[model samples]
Target: MSGDDILELENFLPYRLNRLADAVSRRFAKTYRDLNGLTRPEWRTFATLGQYGSMTASGIGAHSTMHKTKVSRAVAALERRKWLTRTPDPVDRRIEHLRLTKAGIAAYREMVPLARGFETDLLGHLDEQTRRAIVQGLAALEQAADVD
Candidate 1:
């Protein structure tokens, strides 16, 4: 098949989504690592906490679709870095709830603009209507998948 006759991967959803997610993740990981020394899992943990404050480690794992062990390890690493704090749940003394430290909050705040700029650059070429449609479609997919 001639190159001109070939349909490129841009038309395939799974391949395109995986590639896009990996590329974006790698870029974001590098940026965050330089700024805060965060690994991918650690960054995931921080992002989860930044969105949902004070959750049990298990809750984080569930919400992030990560294994409990990975979540626990990331929590420990973040705690050691003073980026997060763990405290016993008042009602469930056996469960430790996680919260972002001041430093963690500040780091998240600093990363937001950079992250937004990166996302904006990625989507900037698309017209507003296409962008909105894409977002709505993705949201619907996530909802259908019960990604809560």
Candidate 2:
């Protein structure tokens, strides 16, 4: 093989991780599109709002692993749909606190079972122990990357 064509698993982590993430996203989008017609960012926004109840845009950004600008855009889209409502933080007018609207909550409730099934199918090959280990390892990698 040419030097340029050499393959090594250790050196391919980033490529593999990106490809896996993309594939999972594509599969999920295909699987869940009919149920809710949710885009990735829209689903992410709903998830963050549902879990945390209420949070500023920066908080959602951190939880969603998305940029502040992306979060802002998503929030705007959700607001336009009336799926979520944003209020100016009383304590800090500059920050907008977001909450899921009743519509958002109902939509989320309806989608939960489908989402769970999608996740379950995605991890069907792995046993619980292996799945936990993989999750822990990925969390460790994310933490390590955050360090200087």
Candidate 3:
């Protein structure tokens, strides 16, 4: 194949972005994983609930950009661990609001500082100029794509 015709996967924007996201997530995952044995989905769900106080499965899935199945499984796992509870809405029997229990809250609180520190460490690798440029570039891309 000619040099111009060859597709370099690593240099592709989407592929690069996806790879970077995965790598960052994996690095961050180690922190929460050690904190309370939380998988990515569980951590997302827990963090969502922790941030929002209470939310439905669909809400958590949408907010966290996780698949419904993953959200359901995380919910089940958290429930099994007595970290969260589901309550049927007063008027809507089909909808359940998920909230973290006191134990879950404690766990979430503990993870917060660790999560913040991890982010600080990640950003610390980049100089201020590069970090600002990256943030601006990502924001521009998101705006161009009309991402919500």
Candidate 4:
């Protein structure tokens, strides 16, 4: 097939979404990275635990769409920083439940406002209607893709 008949990745929905997500993530990463020297996986794991209270490494990986190795490294990093603790599950000796420490909670609280500001700054560039439309369109697309 001719190049003209081939799909353009730049214009593809999946590619566009991935590109947008990476750009947004990098923009937001600066806040946590500068404040706490956290990497993307570490930040994601920390945020997931902060939001969800306690969960297993597998749960965090699933929730954040991260790989097992990434989750493991993040967990280890946070543990070394005294920001998270792991407790052996009573019913399952092989499973460990992870939770944020007091320090982690404090960090999470400090980062919340920064995260909100970052989101506000980005969304503020768009008009109210456009922002609403973007939100609604994203929801529709997620539903269409059968993503939770």
Best candidate according to TM-score: 4
Q: Model 3 clash pairs?
A: none
Q: What's the count of clashing pairs in each model shown?
A: 0, 0, 0, 0
Residue-level lDDT of model 4, residues 1-148, one tens digit each, is 9988999999999999999999999989988999999999999999999899999999998999899999999999999999999999999999999999999999999999999999999999999999999999999998999887
> Best to worst by TM-score, what's the order?
4, 3, 1, 2
Full-model lDDT for every candidate:
0.88, 0.83, 0.94, 0.96
Candidate maximizing lDDT = 4
Indicate whether candidate 3 or candidate 4 has the larger lDDT. 4
The local distance difference test score of model 3 is 0.94
Task: Give the clashing pairs for model 1.
Answer: none
lDDT (tens digit, per residue) of candidate 2 on 1-148: 8978888765698888888888888888875467666677777888889888998888887887888778878888888878899889788899988999999888778777888998898788899999999999989988988822
Per-residue alpha-carbon lDDT of candidate 1 for residues 24-61, written as tens digits (9 for 90 to 100): 88987888899888888888899889888788888888
User: In model 4, where do residues sit more than 4 Å from their true spots?
Assistant: 1-4
- Pick by TM-score: 2 or 3, better one: 3
TM-score against truth, every candidate: 0.84, 0.81, 0.94, 0.96
TM-score of 3: 0.94
